[model samples]
Target: MIPVKISEEAIKEVRNIMENKNIPDGYGLRVGVRGGGGCSAAGMNYILGFDKPKNTDKTFEVDGIPVYIDKGHVMYVIGMEVRFHNGNDAKGFVFVNPEIEKELN
Candidate 1:
């Protein structure tokens, strides 16, 4: 199983978004890496309301919320935690990844 972590605030935010947007059941978050933009190496991206698991993904469930991580990006995402941040400039889920710098450079 893929390693997964989710904060209480993140859970509340996700649930609120889902309810506000009228997203259907089974919708969850998909977090993974994509090879374009920002840094030369893989950068993280996420789909907030995802319905089905991608063919190349490994799944993890935390606090009744499903999170999908792509197989190719697994090594770069291990031990990462999902945090809810409400800073002055940005407000959303932030990925606390130990392998982020390694993946970037």
Candidate 2:
């Protein structure tokens, strides 16, 4: 199973983007953490992009989408869920971590 789970809505949008953007073969979605992430209260911010798997990466095929996670970032995003929001306030994928939500409470 993937360390991070993606919601169904996010999956559909990602597939559309991959087709429209013409993402190259052998390249897949990369999920990772960026330090001091803005728009989030978590210790690290999550990032999504298309990239070729690196030697240090672990790959997962989720619903026909290839996902890559660098080893060092695995722990940070474990159990996290990625959702797509297309409301008036936001129009993007939002990362939600249950652990972080608990801490915030």
Tens-place lDDT per residue, model 1, 1-105, is: 556567789888887887788777766777766555664334546334456687887888876777777787676556776778999999978777656647887
The CA lDDT of each predicted structure is: 0.70, 0.89
| Global lDDT of model 2 | 0.89
Q: Can you tell me which runs of candidate 2 are displaced by over 4 Å?
A: 37-41, 99-105
Q: Residue 7 CA error for candidate 1 (Å)?
A: 1.7
Please list the Cα RMSD from the true structure of every candidate, rounded to 1 decimal place: 4.6, 3.5
TM-score of each: 0.69, 0.86
Model 1 is weakest, by summed lDDT over 10 consecutive residues, at 39-48
Residue 12 in candidate 2, Cα distance off native in Å: 0.2
- Which number leads on lDDT? 2
RMSD of 1: 4.6
| Candidate 2 lDDT score at position 22 | 89
The window of 10 residues in a row where model 2 has the poorest summed lDDT is 36-45
